[model samples]
Target chain A: MLPFARVTVIGLGLIGSSITRAVRQYMPSVRITGHDADPQVRETAVRLQLCDDVADTPGAAVIDADLVILCVPVGAMGQVAGEIADDLPADAVLSDVGSSKETVLAAVREAAPHALFVPAHPVAGTENSGPEAGFATLFQHRWCIVTAPEGTDPLAAERVCEFWRRLGAMVETMEPAHHDRVLAVTSHLPHLIAYTIVGTASDLEEVTASEVIKYSAGGFRDFTRIAASDPTMWRDVFLSNREAVLDMLQRFTEDLTSLQRAIRWGKGDELFDLFTRTRAVRRSIIDQGQDDARPDFGRAHD
Target chain B: MLPFARVTVIGLGLIGSSITRAVRQYMPSVRITGHDADPQVRETAVRLQLCDDVADTPGAAVIDADLVILCVPVGAMGQVAGEIADDLPADAVLSDVGSSKETVLAAVREAAPHALFVPAHPVAGTENSGPEAGFATLFQHRWCIVTAPEGTDPLAAERVCEFWRRLGAMVETMEPAHHDRVLAVTSHLPHLIAYTIVGTASDLEEVTASEVIKYSAGGFRDFTRIAASDPTMWRDVFLSNREAVLDMLQRFTEDLTSLQRAIRWGKGDELFDLFTRTRAVRRSIIDQGQDDARPDFGRAHD
Candidate 1:
């Protein structure tokens, strides 16, 4: 059982629902109450049996709860935190599953001044979203980055780290700024590139546009998966983590321009050199126990 | 049976081997012979029983062949066509599986003027590119875009169309320019972006680079698979399809700039608007029977 014996989970989206399932899977005896702004999601949580008690209100959910995890969108985090601030236990450790940490921690400080806020971003998810998308193994071997602001109690970060550890993830602690920068390269830029390419394909004439989607598996298909992730949630992530994402985007654009110049100038050697070197990283990724070497066609997802 | 009774497949790589396999599976009595530039691939063709008569040379393969299929690299098409131009029977139909049509068609025409040449691009492949990598089901349900010049014989184009149709592909005739434009959006640009991102991740310091790979399931992993495709082939593709790729890259840059601007300004509504719109195309792709929904967690391709 976790040190925090009683926990309140706000929102029953993919992250929230997964946490509810993980808690039940690993610590069944501990009580978990869930709060969602939408009643349909709340009712669905009850139906899925993800939570022991699906509180009709966030206030009811966190009443007397020892810990609270806000699983709302990054943009909505401040508002949700504010709504439950008075209800949160004075000594409770409050955290979030938001992708961006600085903004989340900022909001937590304002909404729940009495509680110990240790901001976290679980670097785990798929293009799929919503409550139904939750899975027990979603975070298996994935990263859970915790960005504790200055003056945050050490015990509070430890308690929050322990929460993610119990849920089957490796935890890392860094300043919120560093976490945002690292993940901007790791996740945000990839999604942005994918969205743009898909949009570019969409802008083609009706005949070829439909055909592009039809024959997307040639290479364009994988981009669509990342491009399909929840919009409002990602919108908030970019809006909140703007600086880092834009910086990385600039680097990517410049690099891509250089490549375009090489291709346009018939520099086959330059193009081949980059293409060859890139393959080594792929081999390294496979050696690191990520990615499989199987043919993409017969693979189920392709 | 194909409209042409005897088929000669020159350059037995993945596409050629797959074509040989698919033909043998569906048309058992059809006469099929294979020839590859490399002796190793030719030997593998014999060991795998991929063809009934493995020809000793390109000339031997095309001799009396009713249909001649060039499966070599796009740059090698002219030489292969020249090597066997005299061997091709007058009524024989010649075709190629090159990624670029205008270049291949022009090259093949220069080599063999009288023989019917229908240029094609099979929109199916894996990162692995060798005789051993070929499988019978590779072309099943994949698109095969054929670009025959305006003056090319209709009977010749239809014969090539019938051949691929027997292999379970939906074949379409397109202008070489249009084929380049559409594929520039669908295949080339996506590959260039993936290669760039994987290369960037590889340039990181040892520790974070290792973690970037380890937890690549977040997004970076997919790029790695594409980055692993044969170096020489992709290099040649970019060099040959330069202009169209550059044009598409320009549009993509503009779109990325808009997105970068939105992120810089913390425009939540704009981010939400674009990201939300991108997801619908993925849905349409799935509905079109192009992409599958279940995210492909990297496959094991040896």
Candidate 2:
């Protein structure tokens, strides 16, 4: 049986569009309604025919939706939830694909008291954004964490989990605060570090911009890909998950300083041991099928 | 015409094995000889037929070769150079594929003062190491910076450049010190940061290693690929290029601190601006063909 009969997705970006496409592919009878604050994106969605209906307002889109997912930046969650509150079906399962769960859950709860809120974060995305950049298979083999707050209806949460499963995701449940902490280390800190390093490389007076780009294949190019991810989304993530992100950053900085001292003091043994240990972590990731096993992520040579 | 009739690679690791394979593919008539300090690696090279002859000793490897490239760690360059010095052909042009040029050049000069030295660094590799991890097209369209010291034979430097070109690499000439500085930002510092962050994530008490590995797709996996690179080679790179790597690390840390502050203060505009600027660098890298243009380094979704 289909988990959701009528789905409404607010903020038609990569994740929003992918949900619509996956629902079409996996649950053909279900209806999809998408809405975006940006008229340009809404127009693009309409032109792309991403949904059964591209509603002009968030409230209009969720008026009859069995499942309403907010796909906007975490900072906008409250406003978007408030916008859809009056028209949102009382029985609808409210969910979101936000990076930080605690803040998003609070924002949604404050804005729509009657809604059955279940927050989720799909641990999958490329550096690209926008409706046009998504595909139906993006969630396949990827983990989707469902952080339904206390008192959330079990049926509503199960429906959300089932909805993701049908769309090709492996679902796991976690506390909202735990989700924020875990993601803060795995996702938030890495993005912050990538952005910092790329900015540092770009502003170097000795190394020209052209030189950095030309020789980036060495290792810098990998960071650039991560750093190129949507700015507004990342800005909101860092702001919304401030405490956890800050804690991770502090730990990362201390670790970086130790490595710096090792290099400065010519401690080859220390560097080698850490590097060897890290290699095992990578092997485990590959063994668990969490990452591409092929060398250079199977990048084409030609 | 071929750049060198007889080529000897004095290390059977990824870079050395790739050179032999590239030579066989691009310059078939060039006789290839190889050697490695580790007996197991030499046996593996022989088993893989990575070279026409797997010499038991470095001296034997370069006995009659017209060109000998040292593909050992930067810290081991002098020892390897000294090992080959006794039997190195008088007309042989000595070069190396080490990450840091200045240190390798100085070490090679100190150990083999009579040899015609031309230091070169091929800015290309996968995280995997050893003979089996290499391929004939590993150097295709990659940059190989040649840093030949002054008062050296220009003909020998040109021959080194021509040899890399034959191996399908684009060659550029730069001063030894400048090459080290450019690569410190482009390669060495990035690897150090990756190694540091992976270590930081691994040692976290709140976040388990499995959790980090499971959710690594967020951004951390990208760092792992770089962190998984050969330990000895990277150790030598950091130690040998200490000054420049330290300088770059200092700059990266300062930038990271600023970003941390912005996040703490909720300075969205500052974070947004830097993230937006870094996005352009990724585009330029793609346009210049320095990296794969596809999203997520073109990682396979399935």
Candidate 3:
């Protein structure tokens, strides 16, 4: 571990504070700094021991740092990049934990053209956010996806991978476009469905809505887990990755319609086949140890 | 409690065995008997000590019982009811633990018109189902929805409500038709969406599908949770509750299209506003003290 000498983590929210906590635990001797545009987060970061030094501005935080990680919502990557670009030292390994690649990369490239930027997203988070929600083990057993555009410096990407490896994450490399398409099906579209359904439930009259909550096991609780994710962060994801998300949403909608039609026509086999097939994926997740048999105790917040 | 003298439970599966385990804890002297069409469930009931007595058939289980709880899939309720209808004692307080109300009620009326049948659904479950999965507190703090048709005896409904209350559940009453509609929004639609999304994910080429599971936190994980639920049980739910489910699904499809359009147009505010509104319902579940935050641990079979 490079001790991430003079590491600057932008945006002291859930992911930011978590990285801070993990660094404090795993690399105690390293000098760590945190920055956030929000005044409250800065104060909270100081109170929560999230950093050795709290910087009021992104430029101050990134100055001469070996690594600068943009931890803001996907929509704000550009603004943060613009703020810190001038202060970012040469040879610094710049990276991001943003969900969408194309949008985040576009922003970083536009602002810090000279920096060795490696866009990466670590797939782990709770529904909660802010400094207090940070935990050191949040990254444990999670996958960190690194999307480096063609012709990137191999050494820069390798260093970024090593950084995450130190943080206790499994790493994989892929093209940015592949990341977006896969995430569109895996993350973006699923979020859209969850949000829409939860919105639909919320729109119900208060009485029925109350019933919906009380009897959430009727299936509504599953949607709520996805729906409870950070609104600003997800909004930025949808807006930034609009085309791919929309494209995946189209496929999902068509598939859902056919399912609806099957149910309407009392196609027992169709419903059974689909339901049966879906179970194998869940089984595979468990078989791979990606999922545990433990109930939701580990996810109390959700 | 009545000690539920001679309680007979049909379908010694997850819910049935759980009811037996719960009843044993709360009413230990009840002499709970269980019956299942599957021999494995019967054997597991014995191995797991979920019931005091194992009956050979539904009729044998119902013999001399004060309370007979039907714990079969929605589709199997009618057959079980028919098998036990002739053997049920005149004063038996009958109830069911099926997810759907209308179809189950219709079958009960057809098979056991003379028996005092009350339709009930415990809004609690795990991804895994079996006698071995039963726990004494399975219904603790969960909601139990009861739907009693008009002209039905009030005493029967009250008995059913008291029964669930003893098992540590709060009860809500509604008409069967209304229960089906509300559940269509709360449970059925969310489940269908999950199954569909998981199915789409599994259809991805092998490499991407594995990555999808490995990096599931991006939202696909929630769908997988729901998709992991019992295939036969869920299939029966969709088939038995076809019209209401399809209706809600249609509404969901329409709402999803509108969301797709918003994502396509990069309407960040629209997405944020919708996502923000979805949190309240989850808050309500937490407020109701029904939200089990244990992740997959508290609910699924380990």
Q: Indicate which candidate wins on lDDT.
A: 2
Per-residue CA lDDT of candidate 1, range A1-302, in tens? Answer: 47678889998888899888888887777799998999899888888888889998888899878889999999899998888888888888888888888878787778767777888888777777878888776776777988988888998899889888888888889888887778777887788888888888887663366878866867998788889989988888888888878878777777888898898888888888898888888778667655665667236421
Off by over 4 Å in 1: A1-4, A150-155, A205-207, B204-207, B295-302
TM-score of chain B only, all predictions?
A: 0.94, 0.99, 0.94
Greater-DockQ candidate between 1 and 2 = 2
What digit string (tens of lDDT, one per residue) describes model 2 on residues B1-302? 88899999998789999999999999999999999999999999989888899988898889999999999989999999998888998899999999998888888889999999999999999999998898999999999999988898888999999999988999999999999999999999889989988999999887789889889888889999999999999999999999999999999989999999999999999999999999999999999999998988899896
Better of 1 and 3 by TM-score: 3
lDDT of 2 at A55: 96
State iRMS for model 1. 3.0
**Candidate 1 per-residue lDDT over residues B151-226, each given as its tens digit:** 9888888888888888878888899988887788888889999998877766655327766775576677777778
Comparison by lDDT, 2 against 3, better one: 2
Query: Residue by residue across A171-275, what tens digits does model 2's lDDT show?
Result: 999999998999998899999999999999999988899999999999999999999999999999999999999999999889888888988898899999999
Q: Every model's DockQ, to 2 decimals?
A: 0.55, 0.90, 0.57
Q: For model 1 chain B, where is the 10-residue window of minimal lDDT?
A: B293-302
TM-score to native of every candidate shown: 0.93, 0.99, 0.96
* Residue A173 in model 2: lDDT: 94
Ranking by lDDT: 2, 1, 3
